[model samples]
Target: MKNKKPKKVFMNGAIPPEKIANSIANHQSKTSIGAHSIFLGQIRADEIEGKTVQAIGYSAYEEMAEKVFHEIREAAFSKFDMTCAHIYHSLGTVKTGEICLFVFTSSAHRKIAIEACNWLVEEIKAKVPVFGKEILEDETHQWKVNK
Candidate 1:
């Protein structure tokens, strides 16, 4: 957990799994929690209606994304006995099979942490103003949206 409130946002650019993993492992300690549930997101190359996705470009409204994320974190904390929460999302271009989002929630017990992790992801996806552009193998592109 943070010894002090994070002065700046955790991540607002390309997300590195190692950095996120290390941060989670470092942030939550024995005295702070008993369990940590992590959700790692990876980009996938897939064919959609005969078009293969080659890459994705992620963009976010920083102010809005940050505000929504903070609210989601606070809500999770109030609804569950979570110790802490960390969220990371990619910015700029991300190629196929690369992660665009990572969320980890810690608690004193397994069940709460698991549920919080799930909830946090959905909340971020629904509430954040993050846009994605799917670049096809043929170099064509389309925008991605929640279905």
Candidate 2:
């Protein structure tokens, strides 16, 4: 088995840029990786009606979310020749312009890395049961719809 266990994907708040940089820096030792694809999902301040979004309050069924994430990883590995993959998502409130999701994939070639990263994001969005509350500026909120 290439993967041993399911990795924890949930972070306490927003995903930090430093963490993303360190992830790339850490892979310097892996000389076999020729390409890396990264996807960062940031909270957008979309104006709905007259109010603008301030932040997103995210929640999920942890047990099932982790399982689904692991399944997605396994499927990606089987489908693409990836060297390593990592995924992280925010759990509490993430303000506008902050990152809530990060997906990284590395491979010997560019296409595989890019394809795996995109595929993982799509699968996670479609399959994982993570819910997001779009908090508006007026203190009202609405459920986020992944489009």
Candidate 3:
């Protein structure tokens, strides 16, 4: 059954590793799930025009983004034979090497889980209205471009 409740998809700052481990541990009792796929998006310290990025400060139109996230989840459930899917993205400042996004999908088979996870990531990158400002080491900022 599709969950109709509005999911809160944004987290403040970076996603902690403990949260990831706890999520996996929570699913252990679901015996029917034969495979799981996970995606973690980490902040990178990229050098742009002689400046090195120190962190990314994220912001979004929350209402619209939540609605879009719901649509993406629904689309994934309908398009794939998946058992469950969860998405979490960071808000505010996330430093380099910190996790900013987490995508998790599980299914009875490996291929389905993998494909659904990949598709979710792509959809989010293309459709979500999340914006990031790259904070340089010197504290100057530039708008991030999704590539």
Candidate 4:
């Protein structure tokens, strides 16, 4: 019998922008997609109630996060005729007003790309093992879970 290859999920503790972009561009070459849609999650400095959030620190439980990410990729592929997808989420720390998650999906049509991109991002936020610490401008902080 032939050996089987294990499924690979593009996951990392700290994601770099160049690598993410490279992955997307490389994945795109595999299929002649007519359109690609991308959604990025960025940090925001805002008050939660009355305390101002100066920055955010992101941490993830990687084992579970990988599982969730793989599942989302599979679902997107099965649900749409997508050429490919690339998802990267910050694991260590992400400051406010900076990108923390990026989802890029490509398909033969723009609609599918747009829909899939949106779906994947929501899934990551809800299902992945990532947590956020909202830092107040005064230097105090608190943990925040996206609801």
Each prediction's whole-model lDDT (CA): 0.78, 0.96, 0.96, 0.73
Q: Tell me each candidate's RMSD, in Å, in order.
A: 2.7, 0.8, 0.7, 3.7
* Model 2 lDDT per residue over 1-147, tens place: 366599999999999999999999999999999999999999999999989999999999999999999999999999999999999999999999999999999999999999999999999999999999999999998999999
TM-score of 3: 0.98
The window of 10 residues in a row where model 4 has the poorest summed lDDT is 1-10
Worst 10 residues of 3 by lDDT: 1-10
lDDT of 1 by residue, 1-147 (tens): 323343234354457767876976686455768888998777788788898898888877777777777777777877888887787788888888777788888888889999999999888878878888988989888998665
Model 4 per-residue lDDT tens digits across residues 18-57? 7667866686466678988988777787777787876777
The TM-score between candidate 1 and the true structure equals 0.87
Which parts of model 3 have CA positions greater than 4 angstroms off?
Answer: none
In Å, residue 54's CA in model 3 sits off its true spot by 0.2
TM-score of 4: 0.81
State the lDDT at 91 in candidate 4: 59
Clashes of each: 2, 0, 0, 1
**Consecutive 10-residue window with the lowest summed lDDT within model 2:** 1-10
Every model's TM-score: 0.87, 0.98, 0.98, 0.81
